[model samples]
Target: MSEKLKVGITIGDVNGIGLEVIIKTLANNRILDFFTPIVYGNTKVASFHRKAIGITDFSFNVINSADQASEKRPNMINCWHEDVKIMLGESNSIGGKYAFLSLEKATDDLIQGKIDVLITAPINKHNIQQDEFNFPGHTEYIQSKTGSKDALMFMISEELKIGVVTGHIPVKEIAENITKETILAKLRLMHNSLKNDFWVQKPKIAVLGLNPHAGDNGLIGSEDQDIVIPAIEEANEMDVFAFGPYPADGFFASDNYKNFDGVLAMYHDQGLIPFKQLAFHNGVNFTAGLPVIRTSPDHGTGYDIAGKNIASEQSFKEAIFAAVHIAKRRKEQDDLLANPLKIRKLTKDRD
Candidate 1:
């Protein structure tokens, strides 16, 4: 419809496989056909990665600013500072600072609308902390930077899409975190994200219980009965199609999960264990309810496999493709909304 949407990518934890995945994913010509990708990291690091991986066809056109980035072509669009000399698979304060700086640069471009969507690679959580940067992960950092309270992390695949009610927090804090207000907020974000960002109309979502067997009717724990159920009831009363208090143990084992469009887990591991098991190579970690689109590979910075040139780029490729599809669908929906008659006729044809 229009020229490809420009996607700004931040190389996460340059010591890890972030650069490798970007190199491998961009090597495919079909990616250029969908969106013009711009990488916001050190051009030197990317060049080193390309050489180490034996990829020679690709090249990055370094630019001083996002405005200088060519919308007509796929460019690396260097946002390089220092730390370009850091060794791979090793963590240092310099690497940590630049990793965070890359994210900040991408955020500025995102807010300015120079990039339609932002896709981040994995960054080391521990190393990312500097004197000024205190956020735990990308999700929290984005939420804080954008002042968005409802932002949540969602891991998606063709079969299963899971969202965490509480993320990047300790297990002891999860039960205390479960509340009617929090669950309702997350549910609304998930619903809006499905309808608007993902283009899913009337999306059905399932909620998982915090305790085993959903607190076994309160014998095992009261959080599921007192916290999760009431939140679900309130959401249902609001006409949201949410059903569950399912035990994390057997939810993925049964066919029950196949009926819903997405699953809302109580916390991180409760959701990720099954998601990684099913779609580790191709799963995408998407942050929902952001003003801008954002996605990353479901996996993290594999320090052990960092410069091996063997890390599979499947998930990164899937993330980029998903971003492109969602961005296109959102634009199309906006156009259709602008033309009501066409939308009505399409609805009539479907009926």
Candidate 2:
């Protein structure tokens, strides 16, 4: 508790509004109370943004590594060069290359334990893809880097958090791809994340049906009655609170989701649609089951309004806070596991 948590952040797509939101969020002095943020990006672009916004009090120090950064002042840990000197709203291949490099730097620092957590801004998916780098998004990139196969992507707000059984795959392919091993792994990952990252002692999870009306008990489809039901049975034996194959069309009809800690969507849009419907303004995209804490804003690069400065910093700020909160919980849990008696005294009386 004596030292501040070092949060390494990636400023994505300098041509987009990533820098704008990062500047706006960290400028608030209250953030210093929670984290010592080390921003991984270009120094020149950050300086240009500082001048454009007419802010003089904020200054960024360049560092080669996270340890070089001091908690006393916010730092811009320079990782790459600004590819092009382009306007804010314009798109360029140079900008994409720079953005990808910043993420690579941050990922390296994270793996080395030089930083406690990773918070990323939005990146242009199309612009950043090159012949050498062919990732669909940040989740896949992190998964490949960490060599983790059981990772799940969850979009979170205070009110709702939805994890995807399948993400970024074609809609037509989802049905064929849904399998028991995949569903079981997703459930276990979500359960462990809630317990370890969120400090939920007994996490409850809901599973959504792949077909309408839960396949009407196999009239419409047999996946819910066969695959999903068997998975839930296996989960029950493990003592994980998992229930469903709930009807996709009617799962959110009432307050059905409120009773569970997290929900597993059949596919991407099935879960994201409701989550964004409720918490788009301040939602966070969290990568569950990573060896380290990772989070980002739930939105994407707004190339249309990249320069207007109207991009809401709310989700970015929320992502930063979520990363901090999860990191703190993970630290606390680790400390408790290292010393069981301390945790017992701290939590035992909650009956």
Candidate 3:
């Protein structure tokens, strides 16, 4: 049997449902069969969450570092040894402080090749802002850390895959940000990600317009006609099978998204609103165009029900699964590339 992949998980916020979901997701021993789970956070914090959730049987094997992670057990690396105050269901600076610590520690290891993939739990964007950790979210942070010039906020699910041109930016700034170069860059990222990361043979990507009804052909706005349309043409000229500056409303309403392998939205909510509405519980946020593989649950910290034991771990679990699958596929592709003649011979034999 092949060796199991090592998955490094970061505790988002001690107060939020991050720990709760992490514990719940790792409770099942069956998951250990595919990946060795290494959690970067305080074990005491994890214990607090495990007990609060009324999970009496589940416990983590506390270790000093990722090198000691066990394949058959859920292992935790304490990011800090100092005692932390548990403030469940609250967003505060303390929560943000520790969230950053956990993320930094795990990500440092990820950069050093200590872990195969990283699955981050939900973190409150507002509270998690600091001098060193100043970015829109995890996607931007990871991008900067890994020196990736372009990264796509790709949302993946069983049904549809969506990418956004503008992520975590204000609505008013979105218009100014949607340029031909930017749109074309995002299209390129989405197209390549579909082909490389997701293994779509011939990815047909659907692009959405910035203005409502796709600018009504310049009646509503000219960005779609002037900028977006030309960018789509450029992508096609470059041999990317991309189509449409489709009206966001009608495109999703008529089930048009189902016809394409991927959808490219002008902004965040344009894609996520419909995606979350459809696959809220199963959607996985994948950071594409990065040297490292990272995935996170689609939902945020359930602050309202942090300690109520009501938070579902389905999305978090799916994020872990997605990270594992993508990492394995990437390795398989790499192995195939190492033996070009074998790949070509396999292709010829198939034909």
Candidate 4:
């Protein structure tokens, strides 16, 4: 039988609820069946979060490498051994420093193929900024690391999947940054991801407009007509089933999102705001169109309820589930396409 897939996890911002959710999720032990999880973080810090949350029965098995990770136990790699203060619910530099440390180590193993998939916890983007990590967020940083030209910030849930044209930019700059070329790129990426990662064949993508009421048929803005519409047409020409510059406000309100395989919003908030409102506790932030698969919980560093243990781990658990399925789907797809010519010849011989 084949070995279980190795899932590399990063504990983001020790001061926040990163470890809390991770501990809670792994504590169940039932999750080890799908993938052997290798967490990149210090064991001491993990214990600190565990005690703070009053979880005494759970513990992580420390290992130095992915190969050393136990098949039955929850494993961890001690990325750092230095002593650090644990100020829960605080957004400080210490939190960001260690968050990067864990992420850096996990990313290295992922790139080296030691780990099959990656699941990152929430990080404080502002504090994590440094010489080594200066990108807007994890998606951009991973995109650069993999030498990928672009990556889509895909938000996935059981019922809905959404992607944005512009991410981590100022609201004023959104419209300016969006164009026909950018929209078409995201559409193509989203289409391929649905087929490759989620195994959706012939995916139909819904595109949202930049302005209200879909620019009121050009009464509000011209970008919907001049940029978005043309992009959708070009995507369709390329054999992608892309449709609509729907009004963002009414798309979710009237339950129109249920009909499509995926939705592409014009900007960050236009997509995320509605997604969070609907699936905040269990949504996953999947970075699509990259060589490697990466996913994280939809929520961010919960500074307000960090050590209180009130933060729910549902999103983190769901992220793990998504990562496992996506990794399996990708591997299966790769295996099937590895030697397509041989399979074609066999089919011809049968005929």
Candidate 5:
């Protein structure tokens, strides 16, 4: 209770708008009251990004480790000390190389319990692939790092919460990947996250149909009727109120997503396309079902607007706050679990 939550952050691609948005977010000292930020990136890169963004006053408190982070100011740890070329708005191997270094260091600190939560900046998915980091995206990478069995790409905002059964896979691979077991696993993950992290007492989840019009009741395709439907039926028995193999088109068009506590789409773009359209600037990409807390901005490496100071830091800021909130919720849940009899006694007395 004496210390603020420690947030470990990764500067995505040096060539992108990662550092720009991170600097902007940390510049606002008001957020320091909520959590202490420990950025795993070089001080030189941060300075370069700051100068390019035309910010003059803000500075990072250089620290050797996340444990030395100051609660009153934003902190930085140099993942790389060498002077890397700053080629803003360009995607190259250099960007990817350093991005991995920052991410790896932050992830180590996160897994080792030096930081309470992690907020990652956007990384170039293509260039940031090598022997050590050869995953589809951060969701899979973090899943592997933390040794979590399943990880759901949960896109969250004030109103909307959507998770996908299949993420960062090609369209052709989607149909084959969608199975009853996968859908059921995602349903269980989202349900538990809603209850424990978001504090939803009894979550009602909406499951979107894979094929058109839910396979037009077996007209278009039988995947929805055969796989998705069975998954929802089984989810009900598992204490998850999952319903609907509803037509994805009409579901978002009619604003039907508002009626449920959470929505589970069959694939990535199916859920994220609509979620981004609704809350692009503020949506937080949460990797649910992991033992550790992690979140990121809904947007990606903004090479198009890098160093222009035009990119909005809203989504990155939202991700930081979301991670902090979820950490607090999980801690409370842990305390309750540790003393179930006391919780029950208090509830009984109140009733």
Candidate 6:
């Protein structure tokens, strides 16, 4: 029998519901059959959250490193041994400090190939800011860490898959960022991600316009016609099977997004708002164009219900499963490529 894949998890803002959801998800012992879970967090922190959630039976196999992780039981690595205060439902500096520590440790292991995949919990983006981790979000941080030329914030679910052109940016700057070159570059990333990562052959991508009613042919704005349209045309010339500067409003409202394999929005909210509304609990935020596989729950830190035990673990669980599934598919694809089967023709003489 083959060994289980080591799924590394980073505990996001300790003050929030990061540990809560993680405990709830792994509480189901059956999940252990799929992959070996290695959590990068303190055992004391895990115990505190578990007790707060009233889950007394749950425990972790505490280890100092991933090599010591247990396949049958969930394992945890103590990123920090010092006793830290737990302020549930609040965003404090300590929470941010530990969050970065956990993330930094897990990512270091990921880059070194210690783990097969990484699933991060929610983080308070503002509070987690520091000199070493001064990025807009996890996508950019991981992109820089892995030295990936570009990274796509690929929001995925069973129903829809969306990618943003300009991620983690202000809405006012969206227009200026929507240039022909930028759109084409994002389209190329999405196109390649769909083909290579998701195993979709010849994916058909729908590009949404930057303005209302797709700029109404220069009525509301000219970006759709001037920038997005030409970028799509050039993408088609490159054999990307790209289409549209479709009006964002009616496109999703009228269910027109179902026709394409992927949708490329002009900015972050343009893509995520609709996606979250549709698949909030089940959606997985996959960071595409990275050398390593990374995913996170679609939702953020449930600060309102941090320790109330009301937070849902469905999305986090799905994120883990998605990571496992993608890793397996990628491995299979690599294996096939390494030892490709040769086709043999039968002729009359041979028969």
Candidate 6 residue lDDT tens string, 1-351: 135899999999999999999999999999999999999999999899999999999899999899998889999999999998999989999999999999999999999989999999999999999999999999999999999888889999989999999999887888988889988888888888788778887899999988889999899988888888999999999998888889899999999999999999999999999999999999999998887999999999899999899999999999999988888877766766776451122223346
- TM-score, every prediction: 0.95, 0.95, 0.98, 0.96, 0.98, 0.96
Highest-lDDT candidate? 5
RMSD of each: 1.7, 1.8, 1.2, 2.5, 1.2, 3.1
lDDT of 1 at 170: 90
Give the alpha carbon lDDT tens digit for every residue of 81-141 in model 2: 5345857766778778888888999998888888988998888888889865688789988
Cα RMSD for predicted model 1: 1.7
After superposition, the stretches of candidate 5 with alpha carbons farther than 4 Å from their true spots are: 1-3, 349-351
The collision pairs in model 6 are: none
Candidate 5 lDDT by residue in tens digits, 64-93: 998798999999999888899989999999
Q: After superposition, how far is residue 300 of candidate 1 from its true place, in Å?
A: 1.0
**Count of residue pairs whose backbone atoms collide, per candidate:** 0, 0, 0, 0, 0, 0
Q: In candidate 4, what are the lDDT values of residues 1-351, reduced to their tens digit?
A: 145889999999988999999999999888888889899999999999999999989988999899898989999999989998988888889999999999999998999899988999999999999999999999999998999999899999987999999999999899999999999999999999999998886899999999999988899989999989999999999999998989998889999999999999988999999999988898999999998889999999999998898999999999998988888887777776897986577568879
lDDT tens digits, residue span 119-224, model 1: 8999988989976578778988887778786797999899888999999899989888988899888898888888887777898989999888999998999988
Which digits, one per residue and each the tens of the lDDT, describe model 3 over residues 1-351?
A: 135888999999899999998999999999888899999999888888988989999888999888898888999998999999989988999999999999999999999899989999988899999998999999999999999899999999999899999999999999999999998888888888887888987899999989999999899999999999999999999988889989999999999999999999999999999999989889999999888999999999899999999998999999999999988888878888999987898789979
Could you tell me how far off, in angstroms, the CA of residue 313 lies in candidate 4 after the best superposition?
0.9
lDDT of every predicted structure (CA atoms)? 0.84, 0.86, 0.92, 0.92, 0.94, 0.91
Poorest lDDT segment (10 consecutive residues) of candidate 3: 1-10
Candidate 2 Cα lDDT to native: 0.86
Off by over 4 Å in 1: 71-73, 81-83
